[model samples]
Each structure stands twice: as C-alpha cells, then as structure tokens.
Target chain A: DAGVTQSPTHLIKTRGQQVTLRCSPKSGHDTVSWYQQALGQGPQFIFQYYEEEERQRGNFPDRFSGHQFPNYSSELNVNALLLGDSALYLCASKINGGYEQYFGPGTRLTVT
Target chain B: AQSVAQPEDQVNVAEGNPLTVKCTYSVSGNPYLFWYVQYPNRGLQFLLKYITGDNLVKGSYGFEAEFNKSQTSFHLKKPSALVSDSALYFCAVPRAGSYQLTFGKGTKLSVIP
Candidate 1:
C-alpha cells in the first residue's frame, strides 16, 4: 500500500498569507497527524485527527488548524504565516492506538 | 507532558565502525519510544519502536535500540555503520495517555568511507 501522500511537494508564500496543505493517509489507516520540521531539527507535533475530528494538539498557535475528511484524508491550514513557519510539513498515518506511524515525503513551505 | 532529548547535534564515524545515537525521554507514565531516520529532503521514516518487553529492539537497515527504563533512555545503535546510514536521526516518545509524540531536536550522522 502507498504510504501517506502530501500535496504540493513545495510551496512559497509571503508573510501574512494563508496556505493549506493536504495529506492522504496510508490505506486502512484511520488516524492522521501533522508535524513541522525546521531545518536541522526533528519534527514538532502540530495536531492529530481521527474520525473527522481533531483528537489532540501540540503547542502550536491557533493560526494553525487542521481537518480530517470522512475518507481519512487530512489538511493542515496555517494563517498569518511568519518566516519561522518556513519548514517541512509532514503527515503521518497510523491506526487508532497504534504506536508505529508511516510518514509522507512532506511539503516544504518557504515564507518569503 | 512528554519530551525527548537527543544530546548530540552530529555524530561522525568511519564506515564499518559501530555507531550510537543517544536519546533520553521524560513522561508521566510508561512511555512508547521510537526512532526515525530522515534522508535529505525527505520526511521522517520509522526505524523502530519500543512498546514493552525486550529492551533490545532491532529494526530496518540493521539498526537497533535498547530501552533502559531506569535511565529513561532509548539509544539507537548500529553494529556496523555504512555511508548510506548518514542522515538525520530523531528520537520520539508517545505519551502514555495521549496520541501525540514529542520529538527531540535530531542528530545528524555522517559516516565517512
């Protein structure tokens, strides 16, 4: 089965602009989580979605939000972007309560 | 709150040499630990996980990690390093009562031939 897939392998936006990133979880996976990875850093948790609702979230600001579709696909929305938001956005998929997670290639966002 | 720590920013070793990437974690209850590798321009890849039992966990690409509860550590190791193993390594911990995973800053491994 294909692993998690993310749209717009790369993106560029200006400060204060809004952007939406998409993700399709691996087949048979019901949970989706998003992370942001800055250069030279491990990924930081953004949020997690399960059953079309956000299950948990991290320390990210309210400017960051997400949605999960009935089909288990997910989208991450970031508004009022800042230069610090420029990083690799990753999508991870797994079954509910499962510990192992599969990841996508990620969307590299650059705020100019 | 759960958190992970990768002490080394970068680890350097020659090919065929053993390599170890140190990691420590803190959580309220039993923790689920994991190791992931990221190649240039790619997202994190799951290398292995420690749920319970068996402190020594082996994973893909001949990688292994030992879970030490007393020390609150889960360090990744490779019996023999390879040039291909040179990449970014991440240590993650899944909170016992939550689904979120707290990650470390990451360690860049460079293996010279």
Candidate 2:
C-alpha cells in the first residue's frame, strides 16, 4: 500500500508571489491536514480538510488556504508569500475517525 | 485549547545507555497524546500515542512512552539508545473537537557512540 505522497520536493518563490503544493493521502484515508515547520521549530498546524470542506484550522493568516479533492488528495496554497513563509510544508492523512496520521515527505518552500 | 511542552532543548546520551525525553501537556477532558520523530530534511514520523487504557504505550523502533495523569506528563523512553536514534523529537496533542495536532517545540536527541 502506498503511503502519503507530496509533489515538487522543493520550490523557490519570491515575496508577493503565490505557490501551490500538492499531496496524495495514504490509501484508505479520507482526512488531510497541512502543517508548516519552520527552521529549528516543530510543525504548526495550518488546516484540515474532510469531506471536501475545511473541518478545522489553526492560527494561520488568511493567506494560507487548502482544498481536498474527492479522491482525498489535497493542495495547499499560499498567496503573497513572504520570506517568513519559507519552510517545510508537510501533509498528513488519517482515517475519518482515526487518531494516528501518516505523513508525507513534505515540500520545502523557499521564499527568496 | 490543548497544548504540549517539551522542556528540553536537546538531550545527549551514550549509545547503549537508557534515554528519556520529557514532555508535558494540557488539555480539557481526556488527553490524547502522541510522539513523533523527524530526521534531518524529513517529515515527522509517528512514534506512539496515548489515547486511553494503558499508560505505557510501546511504539516503533523499540521506543515507548509513559503517560502520567497526575503529573500531566508523557515522556518518551528507550531501554538502550543507538547512534541512529539521534533526531528531533516532538510531543503533540489533539485540539478539542478536532484531530489537528498541536505540537510542542521539538527536542533534539543525540545518541553518541
């Protein structure tokens, strides 16, 4: 069985530009969540998607948004990116009612 | 709001020695805690979780954690450390009414051979 997978292992963007990262959740999983891990810090939750709708969100600003497709894949879009937005973007997926989540390799976003 | 705290910034131990990484959490009602490990340039990997029932939860790579309700602590432990065990360790808890995990600042563990 395939685990969670993410696209574009790395990216480089400039301030005010937008970037979209993709993720394919693990097989048999339905819920997808996004997180941002800044240098020397733990990951901070961005948001979660369930049933193609946002189920929960963290303290992130409106510039960060996400979507979940019917196949349980997800996309994280960051608009007007800033240097501070440069970080590792991780995707985690779990069953609708499960507690454990499987994570992907993550996309490294570099805002230069 | 649920939260987690990993007090130590870094921990170092000799290979083959027992090791412990401390963690504490705060949550309303019952607490669902978890441990995850992250290698350099890699994503976090689930280690173990304490949902309910047993306070001692065993997980992958011979790692285990003890959940203390009175102390509100969940410290990760290993019988004998290995050089390959060196990585960043994170403690987390689920937000109320949501599965989104709130993570603590990670602790870096270095097992020296």
Give the number of the best model, judged by DockQ.
1
Interface RMSD of each: 0.9, 0.8
Runs in model 2 lying further than 4 Å from the true structure: none
lDDT of 1 by residue, A3-68 (tens): 889999999999999999999999999999999988877788899999999989888999999999
Model 2 chain B worst lDDT run, 10 consecutive residues = B94-103
Native-referenced Cα lDDT, model 1: 0.93
Please tell me how candidate 1 rates in CAPRI terms. Answer: high
Best by lDDT: 2
- For model 1, give the TM-score of chain B: 0.96
lDDT of 1 by residue, B1-113 (tens): 68899999999999999999999999877778999999998888999999888999999999999999999999999999999999999999876578677789999999999
Predictions' DockQ, in order: 0.82, 0.81
- What value of lDDT does candidate 2 attain over all alpha carbons? 0.95
Point to the candidate with the largest TM-score: 2
